[model samples]
Target: MTDATTRGFIGQLAQGDRQALLSEGVEQIFPARSALCAQGEIGTRVMLILRGTAKVGRTLSDGSHTVLGLCGPGDIVGEASAVAGEGSARLAAVIAVDSVTCRVLAASRFRQVLRARPEIYRTLVAVTNDRLRRTADNGVRQAAHPVACRTARMLKELAARYGRPAPQGLLIGLALSQHDLALLVGASRESVVRALSRLRTSGIITTSRRKIIIRDPDGLGRAGEHH
Candidate 1:
């Protein structure tokens, strides 16, 4: 069994167990704006994020991009692609939102590890299911909520999942632009701008450059729950 101290999609495993998984993989670093893989591009590897943030999204017919979700440390990218067997292409593009470090595992080698450790395979299944549930939840929220509410919900989730303390309040450590927020919320840039304006006026949040500080988390949570 693995210890509880190791947190991630794969859960905590002994050092030897972790090394066993990484034995067949190579570590690499990606700078911000680097693309790990693009939708429809044939791929042969999966990446396990060791540090930093990444954005998973797809390009639309109009050439605009929609952010599906944010992937932070301990997240996996290109898992589906790797599972698609030989000659499979990506379903979405994974881009480094910030400098990222990850372990790149070849499809065959990844399967080898899973075959050697059934527990790891079971953990992967659980993680994949959880990700699906979260994606579905996000879809429902995006479809049912107003822009302001959705924006607040998104920010709240980000802050809870990846925030750090700041003098103002909780700072979402990820460098997300208004455009990125709009994409995540399925809103227009102008709509997001207006929503942010309202939040700032209400003292729920404050922004400087690309950084956002949540001054009132309780109020923000209320906004998200208001429907």
Candidate 2:
């Protein structure tokens, strides 16, 4: 298996395995925005997010977007539906955050690969479980907490999940703007700004450009949780 920063792929195989899949008709697709692939469509491939971010969400009759989840690099964009074989395109659109390069795996070819790599089933299950838990947890916070508290909780969670520990505490990769923070925590942009201002004034958080420096993390947690 080749170690890709985001998605896992089988690579460096013997010449035979490489030739086997090449004959099975796997193609790459570069889809643009507002592209609607309906449910029960004959799905020919699974997509792995190699770059950029996409929203895996459903559409309402009002034509509004209810973001079911977010997919970033290293994420499996579609597999469950592919596994089932017959279902509507449960996910509506995967709009390009920038540009995306998806390594498409045809269903028949994918099944053959899976037979050779039975362990992939376990890996897929584990990944699905993790994503499910994350979505459930995010739902609870968005429903239960106010914006400021939600933002704090999200930052703490993000720090633990994706951020690397700095000597000072934890540095979240992006210096998230108030707007992004609002979207993440399901709060109004103005509210996120107020909360961030409060956090700054309290000296519990600091920022350098797009990175969030969580100063006094415990204190920040206490402040957010208590309020």
* Candidate number with greatest TM-score: 1
Model 2, 129-154: lDDT tens per residue? Answer: 87779779888888877778877787
Candidate 1, pairs of clashing residues = none
Off by over 4 Å in 1: 1-19, 22-24, 60-64
**lDDT, candidate 2, residue 198?**
85
lDDT of each: 0.81, 0.60
After TM-score superposition, the amount by which residue 107's alpha carbon in candidate 1 deviates from its true location, in angstroms, is 1.8
Candidate 1 structure quality by residue, lDDT tens digits, 1-227: 22112446644445666667756578899999999888998878888877777899988889986788888766678878676678888889999988988889888778778788877777788778877887898899877889888899989988876677898898886768898889888889999899899999999999988789999999999888853
How displaced is residue 164 in candidate 1, in Å?
3.3
- Listed in order, each prediction's TM-score against the native is 0.84, 0.67
